[model samples]
Structures are given as C-alpha cells and as structure tokens.
Target chain A: MPAIIELRDVTKTYKLGDETLNAVDGISLSIQTGDFVAITGASGSGKTTLANIIGGLDRPTGGSVMVDGNDLSKLRDRKLSDYRNQHIGFVFQSFNLQGTQTALENVTLPLVFARVKSKARKQRATECLQAVGLGDRLKHKPSQLSGGQRQRVAIARALAVKPNIIIADEPTGNLDSQHGDEIIKLLRDLNKQGITLIIITHDMNIARQAGRIVQVRDGKVRA
Target chain B: MRLVDYISLALRNITRRKLRSALTIFAIVIGATSVTIMLTIVFSAKGFINDQFEQNGTFQQVQVSPQTDINWGNGSGQNCNSSDCVKLTQALINKLAKLPHVIGIARQTQPYNFDGLFYGSKKLKLNQVVAYDANGIIDNHMLAGRDITQSDGNGVLTITSDYADGLGFKNNYQALIGKTVKLHTQGYYSGVGSDPVGRQQYMQTHCQNMGPGQNCELPSVQITGKVVGIADANGLTNSSGYTVRVPLSWARGMEENQDYGPARTSGDYCRNMPGPCMPPNVLTVTDELALNGYSSLIVKVDNATNAAAVAQNIRGTFKIGAADAETAIKQQLSVFNIVGIILGGLGGIALIVAAVGVINTMVMSILERTREIGVMRAVGARRSAISRLFTFEASLLGMAGGILGVLIGYGLTLIGNPILNHQLKGNNIGSSNILSLPIWLVITVIAGTTVIGMLAGLYPARKAAKLDPVEALHYE
Candidate 1:
C-alpha cells in the first residue's frame, strides 16, 4: 500500500547564538494509510519537531516531506495553512482551546476559517463535540470545564474539519492517569474508524499500543 | 470572510471591552458634533445675502453712477448736489451700451420740482417732480394702473397713490389714469444747490417772459401728461428720491431747452418783466441737467453672474461707484466661506484627537487579541483577513460615533436655533437661523468620519496582521 506520509532525510535546525543544533536531523520515515504510528522520544530528542515538520506547521531545513501526495516543503504559507485546514488536525499537549470561547465555539473555529456558513458550522461543531464525549458541555467555556473536558473540546476542535490525519502532540501530557487513558482510548477509537492517527509522545506504555512505533533518539529514527 | 461575519466578530470584540469602546466613540461624537455645527453656521450666512436682495427684486440690476465723493450706501444717500454733480452722460451711456454682457443701459431724468398740477385750473402746489426711465423703475412698488412703458401716452407720469388721492383722484388711485395735469416748469437751477425747502421756493417762480404754455425766459416748458400709474408711499427710490419717471427722449428735450449756466442772484434780469422782480421767490432759472449729465445710470445685465463682471468692468471703465447685487452676494459668501473653513478646521482638531484615540484603542485591542489572531492565521484565515478584521472593528467604532454625533449635532441645532435667534435679534443681527444643515452635508460628515477612523486603524491592523502565528501562540 502507498504510504500517507513520506520523510526523506528531513532536517530541522536551530541557531543557539554560536552553535547550530539539528532538532530533526536526517529523519527518513514512512507510514501507511489508516495506520496508528507513535513517535517516541525524550523531551529534547526532537519528536515534536518531527511532528511539526510532518504536520506542515514548520518547514524542514533540508530534504522533502511528502504528505498525502503534496510536497510540504514547496507550499507557501497560505497553501501550507490551507493544507493543514483541509487534511491535518493538530491536538496540542496543553489542549489549546480558546478560553474566551464556549466549547462549541472553540470547536467551530476551524470550520469558520473553512468559510462554512454559521448554521452548518454550528451543526457540525455540535456533532463533533458529541463524538468527543463533551456534548453536554457545549456552552461551557474552557475555564468552566474540567481539565478532562477541555482536552475533549480540543479533540472535538481537531475533528471539526473532518481532516484525513489526526496529529496529537503529547495529547495526554497535562492530564492525570484516568483522563490520559480515556483520551488515548478516544484517539484509538478514532483511528479504528480508518483515520490515520500519529501520536507524538515519550511514554513507552502509549507507544506499545500503536500499530508501529518510531523511536527518535539524538534527532534520528531507529527501528 | 463575509462582511456580516466581520461585523459580527467586531461587535463581539467591542462589547468585550465596553468602557474602552464607549470612551473612544464618545470622543468621536464630540468631534463630529462640532464639525457639523460649524458647517451649518457657514451655510446659513451665505443664505442671508440672497434673502436680502430677493425681497426687493433688485438682484438683477447693477447701479452705476459717475465717480464722485458719495458711494451709495443706505444712509449716505443722494447728498451730492445734482446741479453741480458730474453726470453719467448720454455719451457715456452710448459707450456703456457697447460694453460686453450689458443687455441695456438706462438713464433717469433729473427731477423737476412741482409747480402747478392744473386739473382744469385746479392746481395743487407741492413737492418736487421726479422722473426716471420707465424700465429703470422696475423695482418700484406699483399701487395702481400700469407701469409707464415707452408705448404709453405721449407723456405719461406715475405718482404715489397717496399723492394721487390728494389730487382729487379715486381713493384707490387707480382712477387717476388719464387725468391730465399740465406740469408747469422753469429752469429751477438756483434751488439745485440749496436744501429742499429753498429749491421748492425757487421752482414755483413763474417765468413771466414766456406766455401761457409758451416758453418762459427761464425756459419754462410745460407738458400735459396723463397720470399712468401710482407707486406706493414707501421711499420712492432704493436710496430715496424720484416719484415719477419719464422717457429718455422727453428728458433729453427738456435738457436741451434750459440754461446750463451757474447759480445767479434772483434779480439778475427779467427780460419780459419791468424793473425789480415783483414776485418774492421768482428767480432766473438755470438748467442743471444740461450743465451736468445724467445723475446715475442703471445697467441691466444678462443675469446675476454677469452683473458682477459688468459692474467690475464699469468700475474699471468709467471709474464710477458701481455695485451689482451678485457681486455683493459673492463678497458676502466668500467671507462666510473663509469663516466657515476656519471654524470647521477648529472643530476638526477634535476629530484628529479622536482619531489618535482610535489608534490607541485599536493597538491595545490588537495586543490583547494577538493569540487569537495567531490561531486564526494557523487555520485558514489569511493576513489580509486579519488586518481587515481589526480595521473593521475600528471603523465600527467610528461609524457608531458618527451616527451618534450626527444626532447630537442635529439635536443641538434644533435646540440652539431659537436661543441663538433671540440673542441675534437682541443684538440687531438678522433673525434667520444660523444652524441650517443640509442633508448631503450630514451624510458626508458621517461617511467621512468612518473613512478617517478606518485610516487610523491601518497601522495597528498591519502590526496585528504581520504577527507570526507560531510566536503569537506562545505569548502568555
């Protein structure tokens, strides 16, 4: 089967005043369609940088990353953001739901940028929240919601555009054991429904459940 | 994004910081209110000049007189001695007719004092007899009968209806038409240099040398003219004078027959009478009209616009004291325009301050919403859309402020008018309302303020638009 994401010697660098550091150095990886892939690394081992490169949030300094048949390095800022809007959903480690907006409004943000009508945005956002088990908390603001529910709202937001890939960058990092397991299971259930799910985490236990685990150490992927 | 969505989002943002938005809008309201009020006063002042001339129907003609010591203001009236006065001569009149834009030039005969009005031997000895070209008398108020046209009776003269009533005519004075009162005249040149009372006495002196209805040695010329029309009893002339008008040819004929010499002592010579003159007031008459030229010339132009140019030309050409109503209007309006611009600019300073306030508020709002803008950019929203959002927010503030300002301005005018008018009337200024805002001006002020507000937002909106999404997301 053809791979959904392809990375060929991808390298991301950083300037630390005088020294140059490669955050994602010479990474070459491929993940097939409908596969659950876990990128496991220590805090500074560059898993998040690799996720950013694949998610089109940041550009690689060298080599090309092909995602769903589009060259990620060649896209302009607008085209890159549009590609993320149409095909990739990002779930931040801290659950970046807008605190001022209601749960439903937070979920509706992607669809808003998608140029969806208000009525349709509302209908789809409501359904997405129900899918994430936060249907009853639609009108509640992030401040009013529990930590678990806020993460659920973030997940609902990621699902609002019906993107082809779900990229969860340490999705359960801020949650306790019970909330973390529940969020992981929800992500597992979404992947079982045939969406490609990539989890960027250092937790060995979470990586064990993925169909494949790519271990990142010293900015390189090891089999 | 759709326009409605932009407005919706802006509205929500505005309500989030209620006090700041209100304060910003309030500043603009004060600025726009003053601007609108100043414009109103300026427009009203221009209306005053038109109103003044319209009431008298004298807006179409320019008054030209030979350059002299007197300028025709309302009070400094015909104080010049007409007998010794240099006239706007027929030669000059012919020359004036050839001037561009001059439709026609009219001249008035110098007034002849009343000696006797003989209605079949019934005479009313009275004040001076006045004569002018009929067309020149268009502004006069006609009380009865038709105005004297060149096609009228051989010699037609109009008098005040009040004067006609005293002449044994109908109470209405319309019945005075066709009544022949033989006008008896002699050269009353001596009286022309003196006061009215002295002139009255000089005019009654009969020229004995000339037989009845024949020529007097003082060149007494009599003409029996039918009373054509009666004018109102108001001040006869614009400045004040003649109650009668005659054709130019008749006045010219009268001018030719009189003595053109200077004033003389009464007992100089009586060719037909013996020894010292028997009559007390009788004197040798001198013809003033022939000595000088015509006292004034009325130049009719194409319209009010051309009237000013013609008056300027006449002032330049004949070097005379001349005024067209249109020139006066333009002068008055330009003064109003200057005053209006100054006052409007003074008021506009408030708007500039408000604009700065808008910029400050927009910058603060963008800072507060930096993270939100970043999130939007990370999604599908473009840089232009982010800028548009902030600009729309600022413009919304201005539009609301403009609407409120227009209301406040209109309300102030409504309440201020009667109060201002009372003070104006007390101060002897005109009673017209000073705050009369036209509809187009009101619309323009509101629209213009909104544009200004949008322009004020440009810098802050650009700052917001250029913010890096990755960096903005990391901000606390």
Candidate 2:
C-alpha cells in the first residue's frame, strides 16, 4: 500500500550562537497507512525532531515532508494549522491537558477549535473518552487525575479529532512502566482500528511493540 | 470563532481568576465614580449660576451702557456715548410699544454723580441710583412693598430692601413708608495745568461752595419724599445705597446742576418732560428694542415666538453682535464639554492602568499555559484563533468593568444629591440639584473603556500566538 507519511532527504538545523547543530539530517523514510511505527533514539539523537517534521509541527530546514500526499513544507502557518487540525493528532510526554478544563472538556478542545457545534462536540468527546476507558472520569480535572489517567485523557483528545495519524512524542515518558504498557496497548488498539500511529521513544521495549522501528544515531537515520 | 463562543470562553476565564478580575474591575469603578461625581458637581454649579442670573432678570434682560474708562485703557474702546446712546430714545420706546408683539417699554437712567446721605445718627452713601419713569414697565414680583406709581413720581422715591435695611428700619416694607431722606452732594474741582500741590490747593479752594454750613464744606439738600415701595434686594446690591422711581423731569434738571452732560442728553431730558427735544435716531417696529451702540439690549418679549424674528430684525438693523438664550446655552455647553473632556481624560489614565493589569494577568496565564497552547496548536488550532481567544477574554473583562462602574457611579449620584442639598440649607442655593447624565454619555464611556481594555491585550495576545509549537511543547 502507498505510504501515508513520507520524508525525502529532510534536514533540520538549529543555529546556536556561532555554531549550527543539525537536529535531523538527510532523513528519507515512509510509513504506510494503519502502520504503527516507532522512531527510537537516545537523548539528542534527533528522534523528536523527526517526529515533529512528520507531524507537520515543524518545517524541515531543507527537504520535502509529505503527509497523506499533501506537501507540509509548502504550507503556511495558517494552512499548517488547518492541516494539523484535519490530519494530525498529537500526544505529549507530560500528558499536556489544559489544567483549567475537565477531562471531557480537554477532549473537546480540538473539536471546539474546529468550530463544531457544542452539542456535537460534547457527544464526540464523550464517545472518545469512553473509548480510552476514561468514561467515569469525565468531570475530573487534570490535577485531580492520576498521571496515567491524564495520559488517557490526552489520548481521548487526540482521538476526538478523528485524525488519520496519531503522533506521540514520548507518550509514556512521565508514567510508570505498568501505566506506560497500558498506554502503549491502547495506542496499539487504535492502530488496529486503521489509524496510523507514530511514536518517538527512548525505551527499547516500547520500540518493540511497533510494527516498524526506525533507529536514529546523531542526526541521521541508522541503517 | 463566533462571538458567543468568544464570550463564553472569556467569561469562563474571568470566573477562574475571580480575585484578580474583581480588583481590575474595582479600579475601573473608582475611575468612573470620580468622573461621574466631578461631572455632577460641574453641572450643579452651572445650574446654580444660571438660576441666579435668571433671578436677576439677566436671562431675558440685557444691560446697555458706555464702556468705562478702564476698558478704554485696556484697548477695548467700545463705548456708548452721547452720539451712540441716542439710538434708544423715547421715540423708539413709543414705536416699540405700538408693535403687536411688543410687551412693555421702560427707560432707565443711571446716576452720574453719587451724593452721600446724612440723617439722624446714620450716614448712607448712594452708588447707583437708577431713575425709571413711573409709567415704564417694572417687575412687580421684585417689589417688596408697593411699586412706584404715576402719582408718586412727583417727589416720592422707592428704595431697595437693602437700602432700607441700611437705614436702620426693622421692617423695610412697613417702616420705610412715608419716611423722609436727605441728600448730601460732594464736588471736587482742580484747575487745569496745575502742579500736584497746586491741584490740591485748587481742590481745597473749590471745597468752600457750602452755604451757611460747618467748616467741612458739606452741601446738604434735604429733599424729603414718602417711600411708596420697598423693592427686593438682589444680593449684588451694595450696602452703599439706591433710590428708584423719581420723575425723569426732576432728574433732567438735576443733571444740569450736577454737570452730568451724558445723562442729560441720553434720556433724562425727554423722559422728564412730556415734549420732544430732538428727532429720533433709530426706529424699530417691534416692542423689543435693542440699543445698537451699547454692549447689550434688555428686551422683554410678550410672545416668545416673536423673539427670534425680532432678534433677527435687530441684528440686521444694528449690524452688531447679538445673542439669545439658545446661543448663550450653547456657549455654556461648550465650556462644560471642555471641562468634561479634561475630567474624562484624567479618568482615562486610571482605566489605562487597569488595562495594564489585564495584560499582566493574561501574560501570566499564557506563560502558565505554554504546554496547553502547544497541545492546542498540535491539534490544529490556528494562531489567529488563539490570539482572538485571548483578545476576547480581555474585551470581556473591560465590558464587565465598564458596566459595574456605571452602576456604581449612578448609585453614588442618587445617594449624594440629597446630602448636598441638606448642606446648602438657608443659603440662596436653588431647591433642586441638577446632576444629569445623558444616555449617549454613558454609552460612550462604556465603549471607550472596552476599547482601551482590548488595546492593552493586543501585544500579549500576539506574543502568545507567535509562540512556536515545538518550543512550547519542549517547555518544562
């Protein structure tokens, strides 16, 4: 099958005073739709930078980044926001739920940004929360929820947008091993449901669960 | 995003930070309250001044007199002398009286020389003794006792209550009737081309004009007349003294003796005699006759509808400056407007300070929610949308503060007027207090405050919007 995310000689550079650091250099890769891929690397190995480029969160310094046949490199800031809203859902290491909002409202944030009707947003958010096994914790705030539960709520928010891809950057970095395994299993179940999944991680066990694993050394993908 | 959604979001944010929001709103309230109170005081003072003017018959009445010597030295040479004062003569008064819309015609003559009065144990001085014809129009409402009539013009005189009070009368109206008063005239003469000391010697030489009197040369002429009426005391009336309603005939002959040439030629001659001395200078077909050469004309219009037409006709005829009540009101309102703007501007500084508080609070919120913004941006929220959300929050804060300020301001005025009135008891202050706030003023204040609030949020909102998703996500 054709790939849903493709990177062609993607290069990302960071200027630090008088020196330049290449975060991701000459990375060429593709992942098919419904594929569960993990980009694994140690600290400062460009794994998160590669994930950002694939998720359309950051533009590569030099090279083409195509997601679902759409060129992300050519999209402006506004169009990129629209593209992300429609095609990408993000999960973060810290389970970045809006602390002021309840779990249900956090899930509804993406739909609210989409200008969805209030009633429909509520209905969709509720269904997504239920899918993540957080149906009973809808009214709980992020501070009230456990670290693992907050990650679940974040997952539900990502799914509520119904995007084609879920891009998680160290999705279990803040949780214990048991909670991390549960989060990985939930992501795997979502991938089985035909949604493409991409994870950036440092843990070898987490990388083993992915259908395909790409290893990065320095700024380049390892052979 | 829709306005309703923005409002909801903003309201939610405000409710989340209740204490900070309340403090910001309280600042606006204080600013608005000061503006309101100051405006009320300005309005009340203007109303009070206008009321006093109206009581003095100045609202509809104008004073026409020659520019004084002081004005001439000030480079303002506008004066009504013998040549110009002739425009408002007896002929004009008679002509105006014949007009269909003409209400009343009264001629006034100002005293040229003031003569001091010496009676039993008390000495009274006269500054302005206006002699009006007994047949002329008089405001009966101002009469404390009986007004001067045609029969009393022979020798009787009407004094103001202030003058009567000065004469040691317990009841001005009752005690002053049939009482006789004396007049003492003082004359000073200095020969031309004399030195200062020589002028002083000449003055002393002219001081001996007294006949069979004490060595001090006090010329006393006891002209006794019954006090037919006592008039109301306008507060401006000096305790110096005043006598009204003597016959113009006696006053004209008296002007010759006093060498008051201007008073003799102005109206004292024709008003005293029942005959014509010279041809009329200016002719008017309306009862309301204004003097062209004088500073102003005091006209009493029987029909207010004819006022505009008469004023227009006079302006065309005289070719000088003319103003009515409406013009005067507009002038007063312009002054009030300037004062209001200055006060509003000072109050605006306080609102600006409150707006800075809003920006600070919003910036803190943005900093605290950096990761959340990253999450939102990752999920496809646009930068413009995020900026609009923040701006909406600020606008809501301003609008809320504006509403609360208005309520507090209006409430303060409602409660403060009575207390002010109580403090003014026994004074000449008017019975009613005027603190009027038009609806347009309220709307402008609220809208202005909201705009100021929104402006304060703009830079912070832009900063929050420009934050990079990657950088925000990486933030600890």
Best by TM-score: 1
- Residue B343: error of model 1 in Å? 3.8
Give the per-residue lDDT digits (tens) of candidate 2, residues B1-476: 55677788778888988898888777766666666655665676577546544553434432222322111012112223446333544544565456455465445554344566544667777644455445534453344557666554445667766567778874646866777765544432111111234333444576556566655532334444567677765532111124444555444433432211133344755776666565333311211113332222345556555655654554455443333343455556677778877877777677777878878888987897787778778888789988988887777777777777777777877787677666643342324455656576578667866776788779878988999999998788
Model 1's TM-score against the true structure: 0.69
Say what the interface RMSD of candidate 1 is: 1.8
Any runs in candidate 2 off by more than 4 Å, and if so which? B36-297, B300-342, B419-433
| lDDT digits (tens) for residues A28-123 of candidate 2 | 998999999999988999999998888889989999998877899999988899888888888989887888899999998888778888899999
Error of 2 at A39 (Å): 0.5
Chain B TM-score for candidate 2: 0.50
> Lowest lDDT 10-mer window, candidate 1 chain B?
B71-80
Assess each prediction's global lDDT (C-alpha) against the native.
0.75, 0.69
Per-residue lDDT of candidate 1, residues B1-476 (tens digit): 67777888888899888999999999999888878877777776666556555645566677776554333323112313545434566677888889887777666545554465666756655444544566643456787876677655346777665457557664657667767767666544233232334444333575434467765444444567778777765434443222345555555444443332323544455556786664334334444465566666667777766877887787777766678776666766888788878778876898899999999999998888877876776565777778899999989888888888889889988998899877854443434476777898789889978997899989999999888776676577
